[model samples]
Target: MDLSGGTLEIVVSAVVISISVPGNILLIYCTRRCIDEQLRTSFTLIFSLAWTNLIYNLVVNILKIVYASNVELDSAVCKVLMFTAVFTTSLAIWFTLYIALLFCSKLCRVVHPPVEAACKNYQKFHMVLVFTLWVAGVAVCCPVLLYTRRIEKLNTENETYQQFSSLIYTECKTEYRNDLIEILYGKIFLGAINLLPLLIMLLTGFRIVYLLWEHRKATYGGIWIGGDASELEVVRACKIILLLIFVITSFCVSYFSLVYCLKNFKSCYFAPPVLTVLSSGYSSVSPYLLMLINYKVIVRMRCFCCKDEKKLVTVSAIAPVSPYA
Candidate 1:
């Protein structure tokens, strides 16, 4: 059956909320329960990411539902939705990049000694960096508050313009003050904020692969690296980070590509569902991937599945070491 755009949007929003809400909440609970004293920085980043995703799902998707329901909302609500969307998206990207960087630092300390000195104090500044990223996201997204509003139809005789206006009237859309401001904020600034991190993640992923290959080669030789257990944990963490990077990159690339196609080729009627999936797909899926970083969570999940209280107790006493820890 063919669905209208509004019906599809609501359906997509409902699906995203269903997955993202519980997934992010469980991730937050598990991360908090297993926060490592020595690796507080890493735990904090994960916690922030879960919280951001949860907030994004709640604010953006719910508002999207309201909009799709043909309910009239104030311009303030539109502004809030637009602002939250951009702010949360920026925060998620930065948080994921920070986690990847943390893993990269740990791996580099072992695999590449030349960069060890620079990365030594990285953990100490994580809190400062987190604060800065949040503040910067706010500053960068403030323009949304100014430029975004509910689109209303103009008194025009043009059929095409009327059709376009009606299509977007129920949506929160941005109308910048001028061409320059639009180009600057819409194209250049926002593009850099998202694109730069992906570039860094790509470089970090390459470095991680190189380090893993080197470590494996060294192990096959007569060389014995220190702290096999700890190194193994770091290696595991690197693998998770690589996977996380891959997920984020895939979602981002697909989302941007669809956005570009829709902007340039207005007849792309299939964009809505695909765009919705790309937009919220990562938030729904990334938390479960992150749960793999904490072994205690896995063991607890296994115990729960087996319905064995004694196994739970035993798992609790085992003092499982998280890679982040």
Candidate 2:
């Protein structure tokens, strides 16, 4: 069914906000409650990712929904909004890349167990790395803040401007004022920021999957035998990382599709809705992917829910030996 731009944007934003906000919050809460220092350090990228997506959904998507109905906004406000959205989106992608790299590093440990100790040493520096990435995202997108200007055009003879409302309409667009600069920004700068992370993600993702498969084939034989808690932990961690890769893969597909549409069908009626879905889909779906990582959370809660029963199980697992006379 065909839907209006405003309707489509609002629907997509509403769905994203509903899932991202609470899911990120729960992720943050659970991460904080975690007692293992190593595990918490491992989640540094994840926690940052959840935080970035939460802000993007709450601030950018909400504003997009409000502005969808052709409300006039000041040029400065428009630039700030657009810049923030782009910055957060880039930040989110970079964080996902970082996570992919982290998992790949962990997967390497399965092949070279001695490397595990070295990997653990770097865990202490993850927060610093995450902070640097946040700074880098802002710096990379700084051109957006400087070059964007909201322009309003009359819809008289030429139909370059889409109908936003019954009256005047404005759009935030890059105005580098130089053909060379605009071309560089569009082709080089934009491609680096948007496509580079995606390439890294795909590379790291495939390596991670391959390493995981090889590890499983050599170790587990595709079945979990009893009394191997470490094996269980490795399986759970791999599942969570796989879920994250799925989210990134989806974003890569959606984003490139939208980019292709913009280049070829700039004036298509479906562009706006496609843009809306492309921008918001990953943020929306990733949180639920995170919610699925609650396997650890469930196990933690189970320990509290039936402590005595668990203790009994542990005790009974050991067979009693009779003394001979």
Candidate 3:
């Protein structure tokens, strides 16, 4: 079915707010509750991304909803809303890149962490890094605030609205200025958000793949039984990171496609199937990926729902203890 822009906006808003808000809240709680410090650090990064997405989605979609409802805003509100959305979207891109890096480090097994003496230093570095990225996002989106302008309407009712659509100019600046700045922004996004991270993610993944291959070929008898499983686990994690990159980058590319398409071909705004699916697919699909990859979250979800059921199974079944548990 062809959904109107207003309908689409509301649907997207509902889905993102419902998913990201609660999902990220739970993620933050889980990260804080993790007993393993290293595991907690990884979960913390994921939680940070989740938090960013939640806030970004809520703010952006609210503005979108208001605009879709034909609620014109003053300059100050426009500036703040636009800047917040752009800044947080930038934050989301870099946060995903950071996650890809973390996955790579794990795969390399070169993540030989520092001694206990340097734990504070290590955490401090992470804090500084995340702060730097947030600051950079703010800086990148600063120009957005300048685009703020009061949008006025002559006739905003029924037949008058349809006739006056051409007269309405809510955009802050001339098309030329917006285009030039957005072009620069586009290049930066293509490089920083898509190209750079994709390269790093791919490079690290294949390096780990070669390393795993070398380790597996060493023809030790008993090593295959134990070492093989560990290697396989690492490979599995590598696959997850690779899949993560695909899902993450696919969203970036899809939006870029929409931007370019909208720029060159305005007629597509009538809710082309490709455009509609691409637009909706990002928020619709991302939560599934995040939940799937977070092994702990998966465990938590089951335990969250069926804590009593688990006990019943343990008690009812015959207790057969091997040397292991």
Best by lDDT: 1
Off by over 4 Å in 3: 1-3, 110-121, 150-195, 202-234, 261-267, 271-284, 291-296, 307-325
Q: Considering every candidate listed, which one attains the maximal TM-score?
A: 1
Any residue pairs clashing in model 2, and if so which? none
What's the lDDT for candidate 3?
0.54
Estimate TM-scores for all models.
0.86, 0.80, 0.70
Model 1 poorest 10 in a row by lDDT? 161-170
- For residue 53, what is the lDDT in candidate 1? 93
Tell how far residue 40 is off in model 1, in angstroms.
0.2
Estimate the TM-score for candidate 1. 0.86
- Cα lDDT tens digits, model 1, 1-325, are 1254567777888999999999888888777876665667887898899999999999988887776566778889989988998899888889999888888877876665563345344555788888888889899999989999877745667654333221323256788989999898898899899989988989989989998888887777768454456577778778988988998899988787766545633323444555667878889988887877756655655654577555355533544454334
lDDT of each: 0.76, 0.64, 0.54
Q: Give candidate 1's error at residue 84 in angstroms.
A: 0.9
Q: Which ranges in model 2 have alpha carbons more than 4 Å from their true place?
A: 1-3, 115-120, 158-161, 164-170, 220-227, 264-266, 294-325
